[model samples]
Target chain A: MINPQGLMIVLSGPSGVGKGTVRKAIFDHPDTEFEYSISMTTRNMREGEVDGVDYFFKSKKEFEQLIADDKFIEYAQYVDNYYGTPVDYCIETINDGRDIFLEIEVEGAKQVREKFPNALFIFLAPPTLGHLEDRLIGRGTESDDIIKNRIETAKKELEMMSLYDYVVINDEVDAARQTIQSIVTAEHHNRKRIEQQLRKHLLEVD
Target chain B: MINPQGLMIVLSGPSGVGKGTVRKAIFDHPDTEFEYSISMTTRNMREGEVDGVDYFFKSKKEFEQLIADDKFIEYAQYVDNYYGTPVDYCIETINDGRDIFLEIEVEGAKQVREKFPNALFIFLAPPTLGHLEDRLIGRGTESDDIIKNRIETAKKELEMMSLYDYVVINDEVDAARQTIQSIVTAEHHNRKRIEQQLRKHLLEVD
Candidate 1:
């Protein structure tokens, strides 16, 4: 068990598992003090995407510089997009008494897990495989071939669920969100800290 | 992580660290399905102790009778009192989808750990050795001799904390409770189940 004040939460899942949606719900939860991490990427941002918010879009040189300095906690080159979590930003946020939440893919999640052993890793899953396919098909941007690829990729992702700390099924959005909230709330109460606080209180009480 | 629902939870702490208080708070939490095992004792019950609640309050004959019948889950003689948790009750409760909570001494906890590898063993503690003495003395129930012995015993208990799957420090009641709740909740999102569920969902969808 650990503290309630600050945590590095990694939420990972497949392409169509509604991970982003669940994260949104957690972010909007009342009195929640968690902050979303900004991924540093070499990819160009589309219109309306702000730097340091949507993502800290970086030039190839800057991304390489950060990597050289070990400023990026975990970075990967995927299909020309140099994407990684900024290390210092998350550490700073946690030190400020606020948790940093990361929404990353399975590979990225594994990398974060290695670095942050105690960080909470939550695996979000689609309610049903059919639902996952429906979501993919419903997206007008993708062709049938692309949708098929995504579904296949999701299957591979499923194989890795056992690697995470928690596997949360997104069958019911509200229930899943509640599960996330409660889990986050509970992590703060782990054994060592609780003992410290209680011992302190017991001694101070009288 | 694996329903963690049907798992056994072994709770152990030094005497006067208020393991009972923490256990009580855990049982009182809503949506928590747990059966706090009632220990059977060969010793006579003290005043205000309820049968089948605080303990089974068995006579030596009854206790031996149960032992002969193989009714106890894990039993041992401690400080002249023959104490044991009814194995039948724990099995029944766990099979019923409720987690079993056993508040036992460190020795008994080890037995539970050995018997049930999936069982979650949590050690409760105070922040430091100095604080432990304060809590024990604050209770005002033990003689000076007894208090000293307890302090010595508490050190042994602290040493065993590292063996436990998790440790909880009873620094403050509510905060400790929150941490435990989170660990349990987060654990419930077992990676195996998600993988299994995802694979099953994928098959259906395909």
Candidate 2:
């Protein structure tokens, strides 16, 4: 049996689009072959956050060095803290024949797209912009003005939906998860990938 | 809400690859939104064959007229009989927002590709050439010589796999069906289609 290269899945959307809930739902499925890609971050570890599981914690200097070395697929600085997807980890995971998932934002996704255009980019869209606004307001963590700002940011982020390979509506968590799972499964059977496998099979016989 | 255009799925493979079985399994799934396209044929229908369900039986002259009128997306002459895919029916079904599955052979698929490049072309591959040979033999209706010729034809057909969008191996009937169903579901969320839907939502001022 020829071992096919695993799919690289990037799940992203505007904040409060329920991406996290949808990701969790997909991860919870027992039959899905998935590995979550741990990103490197310069932000201090929050309470109960594990260094590697939640994120690969690094100092500002260390993160900058990685940047200098071109070790990241995409990186961004937020409030003087750096966050990025490590190129090495993604390459290793995909080469290991296991599908890897990256939960990222639009800007990070754009950067990743430049590096790996073949990756399956899925946008987890809220049912509507109004629904997205309601979810942001429902969180109760931000002031009304902040919520307003978040909504405005979301509109801009939503424009990135056209850049993705699939747009899964997060009307219901399970449905969105199922749709993502289907995308991954179907992508594995993509003809270009299968052609490489078949070519190998052809060579062995001749 | 913008009604997204439905997908046209072209299922093709070598003879005796169990395309019918796989297609049935997918259609049996309650949630799969599929409408089978009824092809028109000049060949005489056998006993108990319904006019529309089995095929749109047509006279040789009528079929030729349709060909001249460009009513068929693809048409082929086999043993003095004609078989074709009608363009109008497919267009109407897809415009109605329902996915249409076209079980066509390589030549017909190529014609469809010329007409609609975006149609999802899927090749149903056998586990191996030997497996395909065994399948033809197991059918027990063909002579040894006929079986040998069929196997040779299958080999040539397999080479066309590279032209398809995806290739699903028919090692197990149910699994193959599930994969096809997934392809259909996943294609519904393709980025290009969702962009149109999203654009409508973007223009709607709240």
Candidate 3:
């Protein structure tokens, strides 16, 4: 029998695997609803990006303050930029009956798993390593060295592919999006969720 | 991490609850593949149903013979009709990597759960008892006595809702289809699946 409970989908991928793009497509999905995880990052706000919406941009000092206070569920420093996922907000939303979505890097995703063992971890993979490299460069914002560094990071990420639950190849946007949709929809229909639906059903019948 | 090995989704409900219709929708789905569970029955075939396809319609003697030989995994008698899920077929399909879908009645679903505890059981519910009544009447094949028995059977079936894993209210055709789809997808993206996916992924990378 199916159990009915809300599921936590922890989505992670390397820098240029179009995780952001996939999220955008999912946000516009007609039948689904979600609460996005806003990360507290030490990285400088990029052009046109807003704090609290695009990212909760923090200074090195402010980020450290939160870390010392133990406010984040998982935190990491990438190229001197501190990033962390806030725990309370994500948990609250899920408790309120909405599935929480965490878009994080591999390390952070691992941390979340350690903490929330039931959370679903999905890894977004590019069609090929070559495609990932091209996507990083085609973005045009990063310098050659940064692009190269990201590629190396991607290799390490791919090595940790086993750490993810699902490897979604982002070859075709529509296909990949559908994959994500299928996966997420599948999660909501978890055993606990189904049991809940059944309980409601029995009550209605009785 | 998401598990790579797929899941077994047991779609169980009462007769005329549109389990077949829901299964048909899922079968026709383009993005995903599923395996249908073939059943063994002793009920004489009604017109238009095929053997080995609609059911492995067997005689009482043949079914009892198989049972005595211990060839059947699980079997039950309902309204003087003997029905069962053949062990060999389920094993073959499950090993083939597709989720096994069994359109079973409540008792049969419960029995299957005993044998395969990890199977995802999704309860297909008609919108209302009235709707169920209408559906049974719309069949136009059964006698009044059989129709009354089915309606009573449906009521008893609803009482078994708590025994199921998930309950999907199948009201409208398209909406119910989507709900079932979502439920199935969600189950595949569960924590255990994540663990399985991550393990397989590790093997692939290694």
Candidate 4:
């Protein structure tokens, strides 16, 4: 069977939106045919964080070198640390017939979209902006000022939802995961890919 | 809890392509929220066929009057009988927040596309043209010449697959049903709809 080429999927959401939880559930499914694109970050590795699995931990100099080489598909400096998706790894994985998920922020997602316009860009959202604000404030660790800042950032992110191909509301983690899985499955059956198979079938008949 | 507006889906395929079987399986699912568009046909009702259920049987004059009144969304004359989808019924059902599936041939589907360009157009195909020919021959009811003619028509229909948004391979009935179901589910979460809901959510916060 000539399987369809794997889709390049980019997932973006504001902080505290449960994007990680939903993605974890999707990946944990044994039947999922997806590859997680590990990002390169120039941040100090926290305790218990594995080098490659957690992130491709790099020194600032190395990260800058990569940026100079134009190796990153989309890179952003967050809190003085450079973070990016390695362009080569993502392309290689997608070419290998496995969908690759790039979980990034709205800014990085936009940058990636410029490079791969055909990628399936999805946004994870809270059921409501009120619910989003509540979730951010619910975390006791963040200070009042930080929580307020996070909420504002979330509002800006929500504004960018229209740019995404699909939006999965994180009302229920399980349901959100299922919706994402469906999007991936349905995309595999798209005519753009099936047409190639159809042409081959026609050749056989001729 | 504002439900998303219903999607208008057009399923088109050649004869002996199993479009009906796939649609039946999709609608048979208890959770599938869809209304099958009842087509208006001018053909005589066969035994066990109930008017408005199997088809909306109409007299030749009545069908002609409908055509004159511009009541049909897309209608065609086939085998000396007129068949069509009532424009009002489809629009009303979709506007009521229920998805509507239009199972029609390639020509009628193209006609519907002009009115509902955003409609999700799906093409159901056999695994291969060889498999399609085998399925047509497997029925044993049609003569070789009829089967040959059907196969040629099928080839022309297959050529129209490129115009469709999605192409599902009817290799396995259950799998194809699930794929179609996924498509509906994923479409509900499209960003175009979510943006509206999100805007309302943002307002509530303000």
User: For this target, which candidate reaches the highest TM-score against the unseen true structure?
Assistant: 4
> Where is model 3 chain A poorest over a 10-residue stretch in terms of lDDT?
A197-206
Q: What is the lDDT of residue A164 in candidate 4?
A: 90
Q: Please write out the lDDT profile of model 4 over residues B22-94, one tens digit for every residue.
A: 8778778887778999888887775666898768999999999989999988998754678788888789888
TM-score of 4: 0.89
Give a tens-digit lDDT track for model 2, residues B1-206: 44457889999888778876777677777867779887899877766668988689999989889899989989877435687899988999888877788987676888899889989999988887777877878877667987887777777787888889898889899899899988888888888766786767753545
Per residue, candidate 4 scores C-alpha lDDT tens digits across A1-206 of: 55545788988888778776677787788877799888888877756668887589999999999999989899987646788999998888878877898887677898988888889998998877778778877755567887788788887878887779898889898898888989988888777866786667754762
Candidates' lDDT values, in order?
Answer: 0.75, 0.82, 0.75, 0.81
Query: In angstroms, how far off is A150's CA in candidate 4?
Result: 2.2
DockQ winner between candidates 2 and 3: 2
Candidate 3 predicts chain B with a TM-score of 0.86
Point out where model 2 deviates above 4 Å: A42-52, A56-71, A79-81, A199-206, B41-71, B78-81, B202-206
Kindly report the root-mean-square deviation of model 2 from the true structure over all alpha carbons. Answer: 3.2
Q: Which ten residues in a row have the lowest lDDT in candidate 4 chain A?
A: A197-206
**Tens digits of lDDT, candidate 1, A1-206:** 23434788888888778876787777778856689987888977756667887678899998999899988778887545788898887898988778788977787888888888878888887766788898878756568987888888888887778778677878787788878876666555454434554434434423
Summed backbone clashes in each candidate are 21, 0, 31, 0
| TM per candidate, chain B | 0.85, 0.85, 0.86, 0.85
Residue-level lDDT for B36 in candidate 1? 85
> Model 4 residue A128 lDDT?
72
Positional deviation of A101 in candidate 4, in angstroms?
A: 1.3
Ranking by DockQ: 4, 2, 1, 3
